[model samples]
Target: MYIVILNLTDKKADAPAHMADHNAWIAQGFEDGVFLVVGSLKPQGGGAILAVAEDITDLEARVAADPFVSKGIATPHIQQIAPARTDARLSFLKDVA
Candidate 1:
């Protein structure tokens, strides 16, 4: 599992220009079953993505392809997590450990 943070950068104002493409990229992530969750970061800090992938390279490549990254509208920081345990509803996350 990974937590991908799209932290806003100096070019944040350019976001609206790339939003449609960014949204398309997000949709592709979901359609591909890589992104488990995605949403805003409070107070206009950009966004975050919860993703799971078998290969870190694949995940890095995916993040690299986000419009926000390509356009320099945000910077990405990927944090890997090995799920040791989870609540009953989220037990599936443990498989990625």
Candidate 2:
């Protein structure tokens, strides 16, 4: 799984131009089953996206095509994680072994 963190460098005023396209990309990502979860950081400074894919190449390609990236509204810092353990508080991991 690849964890992509998108830091919004631009101001909120510039969000509108990229919001629509960003939402569309997210919607498509859901349909394609590559997106795990996406949400904004506290105080709306930026946002983070979690994705699980076959490889970094695929993840990179998809993120590179995002509207925010294309418009320079955001930049992504991607990381590869190995899930060591999880608590039951997370519903999604309740049944995961």
Candidate 3:
């Protein structure tokens, strides 16, 4: 799985314009079972998004085309996650055991 962290910089003001597109992407990701969850940082500083993908390349392409990235609303910091352990409620955890 990959975790994408977005930090808002120059285009914070453009958030509204890109919101619709952002939501659309998220919806599509959910339908495709790629996105896990997304939320903004406290005090509205920036945002964070978590996604599970087969590989980094696929995740990169998706992030590159994200509305926030496309519109320069936020810069993304992506990382590969290795889950040593997870709650039993997580779907991925089921596969692990």
Candidate 4:
């Protein structure tokens, strides 16, 4: 599993230029089953993405594909994790470890 943090770098006024493409990129991630969760960061810092992939390179490629990254709207930091524990309902996450 991985936690992808996107820290906003571009001005808020620049959002309109990239939001549509960014939203589409996010939607595709979910549709592809790579992104497990995604949401805004507190105080509008940026956003966070929970994702899983067989290889970190694949995850990196996906993150690179995000419009936010391509447009220089935000910087993404990917933290890879090996889940050693999880609730019974989410035990499946262990497989990604």
Residue pairs clashing in model 3 are none
- TM-scores for every candidate against the unseen true structure: 0.94, 0.84, 0.86, 0.89
Ranking according to lDDT, highest score first = 1, 4, 3, 2
Give the C-alpha miss distance for residue 44 in model 3, angstroms. Answer: 4.1
Clashing pairs in 4: none
Best by lDDT: 1
Pairs in clash, predicted candidate 1: none
lDDT on C-alpha atoms for all candidate structures: 0.93, 0.80, 0.81, 0.88
- Positional deviation of residue 91's Cα in model 3 after best superposition, in angstroms: 7.0
Best by TM-score: 1
lDDT score for residue 53 of model 1 = 90
- The digit string of per-residue lDDT tens for model 4 on 2-96 reads 99999988465576788999999999999989999899999977999989888999989989988888778888999998889899998988886
Clashes of each: 0, 0, 0, 0
Question: Tens digit of lDDT per residue, candidate 1, span 1-97?
Answer: 9999999999999999999999999999999999999999998779999998989899999999999998899999999998887899998888853
